[model samples]
Target: MTPEDRFPGPELPETGPRARLALDPLSYGYESGDHGGPQQPWAGPGYGGQGHGSQGHSGQGHGGQGHGGPGGAAEGAVHSGESSTVRGWFEAGGGATASGFDPDAPGRPPFEPTDPPTLDLGAPVSAAPPAGAPDPLPEPADTAPVGPLYAVGDVHGYLGELRAALYEQGLVDADGHWSAARSRLWFLGDFTDRGPDGIGVIDLVMQLAAEAAAAGGYCRALMGNHELLLLGAHRYADEPVQSSAGTASFLAAWRLNGGQQNDMDRLEPHHIRWLSRLPAVALEDGHLLLHSDTTAYLEYGASIDEVNDTVHELLASDDADGWWDCFRRFTRRFAFRGEAGPAAAGELLEAYGGHRVVHGHSPIPYLTGEAPGEDGRPPLRITGPHVYADELAVAMDGGVTMDGRLLVARLPLE
Candidate 1:
């Protein structure tokens, strides 16, 4: 059955902080040398024993509930797509011919590849001055009126749940239009897969983006693993691609991970362009935000700016293997769990310049090893974002796939 069929409890009966769940001693996958190796300080497998074929994040079904799917910063944002973990179960080998970059293929991006894509890096536009140029003066901070900042985690495909969450925050009016005047909003990605109405969710987010910008506020999103998967499936279809463990095709992987046909059928060229334009990571108000909780982002660049640039550049390209590689690295999760969790969060913070790392991808219930009620225990009640890794990282995915709430929270959590 699908994640939606599997998890049918409640769509968030409560809100706010709840008691912390006890963590299992061996909750984190941690089998070292899977990829990061010893050279990378915060490297290891996702969930325990998960490898290229291991289960990291779960996918959901139709309606608005489900699970889904992360990477590194090179010079810009995560170009290698935060270096995701590959999930091809068969043996690795493929004989497919070159099959990307066709204009008719969904891989043919509609966005102008020439544009710098600096629209939402969220990083200050300062790195190195021109040769022999004096360092640029620090710009004045804006004192303009601004609304509160809020973040929504992995919507999967649940449009209704997302609408309620946004309405609860007064972000949208009764008519479901952007009503947050000057309030800033960010979607931590995973807009599709495992649920229904992913396209609808994207439409709402796109609408909000335009309306919010016009209102002097803004709506933005990060790239999620499912986005990459959907893009790949559209571009390559059933064409086989090589992965660390085996040969897999984008179409198969996408479907295996809760990719719905309706979303694919309704996907428009404009959607492709918008998805391609999204950055893999961003930093604002002292918070570093991303999709998955993996250190593969380090594989992309050394800073948030570099990581975002790299991801955009890659998505704009027609290289199917490169796209698959990107998807694989981001899939590797559980970086901020177990005893090494704090250190993993530290790696991203020290490199990216955020006081704390806020992310979605790994659901809070899975982090505690029980997923609440799954093992015959009472329902694992998730009321708010999970703060762990010594309080250095916050998990925003509320496991909507498991009948959990689609979370939306104010930033700078107390």
Candidate 2:
């Protein structure tokens, strides 16, 4: 059977442990030399999204050699090598200095950059106008439009699909260079593993960061579970781990999850450093953006900064067990699914401060109970994101790795 055959039939009504652990073999790649043991070809049961062709990385690492921010916190700082376009945008957005804007800071307000401009409530109104002479309302001043905000779901190495989606949104020019000036884009992560061009996907994102900034817009990403898995495979390799499914090694798990060999071979220190700095959770435009569907994030920290800092610090450490623990928690999913999903999403929103949670990990077809079409293939098109949990959360994964759609939706789900 071919790798496509590995895709399971329509998802079951209920997600079981087996469904949660369904290994999308097509998602992983292995360099022939990287794994010493006999290659486990995709002849057996595993996850679905596997790519037969090899993908290579040709681009070099970015400026700062991976560490660009002042001190150790690279968050919110611009790379020195970036063009003046992006540098100006960064400076305009107050990226030059750390205002120490904490979402959960005591006596301070949460970070809600997308909030509407506030009006002064204490302005004294002119003495009541005489009965027949009402003062003409001052004409409203004209203001330039702020660019639209865009979010892309899991790419899973489908570089062509990704480029097409971005082009469709006019975020990228025909040549795939950043074109949406003053607009913002956020990638929900999982650039590698499962599919054909993981490294290529990462390279594009890295390149676009500079281009987008130069255009007066910015592109940012969140850390996904697959990123953690890849890091574990590279760092811990075959080291054993304590898993609920008995003992397992990072390398073994990586291969099982469709980790590509070519992507691994091309993995560099700069890439590792870049991945390490990614924030696991963020609040954007009042939407809580995260990679996984699970509430396991709360285990890391109460606030977004705390959680991101903890993950970064853990990655910087050399403790294999600590890395294993971090990987294990990230692998969890569906914390905001099923009947209990709304309460979970609400709890997270209450604590993190957001009207709704937007994420990319679980697919919409699975959440909406839409079965694969005839011949066991996903629908040709996905109209938009799946809003669930009483509209408390919006799922964007679209399951590109599962023969489903690659979603890129505008924010503030209606």
Candidate 3:
């Protein structure tokens, strides 16, 4: 068999994160004398046997959601608008062969200079109830000009669940359009993968973004590690890249980490652009919002804008190793779980300018060790968002993918 055939494809969800270390380009060039040689910090088994992957930040476990069918590629589908410069560079260095890689693949992206995606930001959208639905009670015309600030946890392609959560908060109307005018909503990231209808979820968020802005409100998102993973697979599929274990590729890693085929097939240019440009960090009402709970973001930039801009620029580049570094770091987690957690949170706040850090990557059940409900189902109530690390951090990933709650909390938890 050819080296390509002998090379292992993506791992199973049950595989330890150590399996990932083999694909982390950053893990290459390191010389360790350990069993598998000097393994990197992320090059280990699951965390404390809690089932966290070696990818560290991915909370996927045996029971975790995201296990799905392989994303099938449309044979011979060449990526259109691909930058010849990027293709040339990769080809020059024996980068992954682009010949048979699926062009419609979700990850490999091309550069296009377009205005940052904006929701309508135009005329006010009239909230009209559907037929047979009672007219919604009118709010006082003098309601607060700027509505409440709220955030959502991970929605791993569970579009129905996300819609329900938003609707419960009155953020969306019965028809699933933005209903809360003048209200700000933020999705903490991980909108796709590991469940059904990831693309549908992105579509909804995109629609609501426009609808919300048109109604004098705004809906925004943050970048998650999965987004980084998807991009890497798209850009460097089957490319033999350096790794601690020898050679690896993003396509294999993405598949093992719950890359949904439907999501990839349905991916469009707009979706790629939007995901690529998502901010890595943001401060709102003294709350610092991050997608993952790792301190690795500091490696990207010294400040919030710097971090986001740096990440965005990196995503635009054709550097395979650079992209892997970003993906690896973003997959780190548990920076605020132990005694030093508060201190870690404080460090982010000190640098990023926020009173508290709000994040969603590690699920709440995993953090608290809360067992699933009776009958092996997820618990009915999560109570509320987890305020931990001496109240310096709040975790919103309620483990929705694991049948856990999908938390939607207002900012500035008191």
How well does candidate 2 match the true structure, expressed as C-alpha RMSD?
19.0
**Superposition error at 334 for model 1 (Å):** 1.1
Please give the RMSD of candidate 3 to the true structure. 12.6
TM-score of 3: 0.68
Cα RMSD (angstroms) for every candidate in the order listed: 15.6, 19.0, 12.6
RMSD of candidate 1 to true structure, Å: 15.6
- The CA lDDT at 84 in model 1 is 19
* Shift in Å, residue 148, candidate 3: 0.8
Q: What is the C-alpha lDDT of each candidate?
A: 0.60, 0.57, 0.60
Candidate 1 structure quality by residue, lDDT tens digits, 285-347: 889998988888999999888988888888888788888888877765667766667888898
If scored against the real structure, what TM-score would every candidate get? 0.68, 0.66, 0.68
lDDT of 3 by residue, 1-414 (tens): 111111222233322221211112121111121112222232112221112222222233323332111232112222222222332322322222222212131221121212111111122233332223222323233433476788888887778888887877777887787787778889999887666677898888888776665565678899888788777766776566654345567765665455555566667778888889889899988999999887878888899989988998898888887887677667666677655667788888999998899999876654554434223544435666888777888888877755566777766666
Q: 59, model 2: CA deviation in Å?
A: 28
Worst 10 residues of 1 by lDDT: 2-11
lDDT of 1: 0.60
lDDT per residue as tens, model 2, 107-179:
2111112212211112211111112221222222234326677788888777888998787777776777776
